[model samples]
Target: MSPYKGNRKINIPISIFVVVFAFILLVIPTSGNTEQLITLDKQKLPHKFSIAAPEIRPLVYIDKQGNIAGQFITMFEHFSEQTGIKVDIKVMPWGRAVQQAKSGNSDAIMPALYTNERAAFFAYPSEPLVIFSGSVVLQHRQDTRKIDSWHDIHDSQIVKVRSMNLGENVGRLFVNNRNELVEVVRIVDGLQMLQHKRVDYVVMDALIASSLIEELKLQDEIKVIVHPEESRLSNSYLAFSTSFAAQFDVEKIMALINQYNDPDKYIKQLEIYSH
Candidate 1:
């Protein structure tokens, strides 16, 4: 013990040196290392962006051929190419797609109108995808209600597709009047009701109304009138869920959206598919 006690003092410094050397070896990535620290760093980054949208025609929908097709699809494809970020777009029922975004089960939802309620669950860019207005659809000869303003229809029977967020775009009063408001499952049903004289008018987005009229061949039966000047124009956005926002650089994505959000470009794209 006496002989080894002298060596123990020297061994203390050696042990310290060994610990420091081992730590350096563990931290410093080597060219021959398969599990390189740089590789781990790369794994921490996101590879692709996911988006969800409703089956709304001419905007985003599944065509008769069972493929996702629309202006929004083309826009996202361009975005993917511009940013080098892969995009996975899924088309589903409007209500289900919105619910999934609200619950953060999906990365993003497109063609969303901005609202304080929605802002709670999603992060919207200042740039808008499209600027549009809503219109009141009436039967050709059955309904003769004059909508000089939004309130003009307060006393008339008004129907809209269920789960449509028109109230946020128009106002609470647009959908809050129990006496006049009726919710239906589809825009086609609302138009049918108006055509059959069951409802006086149907409120819907102008672009959507145009598309549906052409699709259902109801142009002869239904007429669309834009909301009065007092009504504010609504802007649609490609909104990301809050959880997805936390994972990606939302500001960069928004910057890219602003760069490409040209009114003329979108109008041309829509016109290409318009009947």
Candidate 2:
């Protein structure tokens, strides 16, 4: 009787072990098959994509010291490091660049302002790494008074570069009277226009305007007006191709941007490249 009881106990444990082992074996193969499907999906993405940047001053495409001047290089380098993707930077005219990105000739744009219309053309990461502030600057005219708000700009004839979008958020506020906004091709021309009293104001990015003013020695003529800050017209970002959403990883791109935003690290990194 004791021998029989011991045999029964051993058989029960052996049966449980066999059942558990079989279940694990079944699960392992199923898990591996699911993983393979995921791998296959990743492999189906397009191998390469292109990107473009609007000809924004000091930010996207700028020619400084006979060199392509802008933060676009820095932003692209960061993107490449994180995604291991190659991007062809085509420094075309602003209008052409937008057309290229819109038509899917390129995979993305380096830095772009947000707009409802633009949103339809490209994909954007939920977060923006770079923040931009713009202002209307011009030659310090003799009859200047306290310029305060967008309402103040209504009557003024402003000069902005052709094919440039201020952004949907601020566009409505600044673009009430299209006649007042003169479109110029070159910043030099715009500055010259301002100096010549051809335009009452030039809506320009603060940094680009400052850099150009210093580079061109236009401080004597142009001055930054201290009006009520157009806080609404603030911030733009790096945009990606919506079509390549599967091919590119958004998290990695965001991580790269976060690294750029780190003052302690990115500044040093920029200096290394700058020098």
C-alpha TM-score for every candidate: 0.67, 0.64
Model 2 pairs in collision: 50-107, 51-108, 62-69
Which residue runs does candidate 1 get wrong by more than 4 Å?
Answer: 1-46, 144-156, 168-178, 258-275
Q: Candidate 2, 90: how far from true, in Å? A: 1.5
Clashing pairs in 1: none
Q: Candidate 2: deviation at residue 234, Å?
A: 2.7
- The residue-by-residue lDDT of candidate 1 on 1-275, one tens digit each, is 55564435333667888899999989976774444434423544235667778666677777779888887778768876665557798987677878888787888888788889889889997777776554444435435555554555565677876656755434544565633778876566777887787877777766677677778877666765554541355677889888888776666676665565553343321111111
User: What is the lDDT for 116 in model 2?
Assistant: 82
lDDT of 2 by residue, 76-193 (tens): 5775655445556766666777777777677677557778878886777777756644454553444366555545555667777764566443365456464366777666678787
| lDDT computed for candidate 1 | 0.66
State the C-alpha lDDT per candidate: 0.66, 0.59
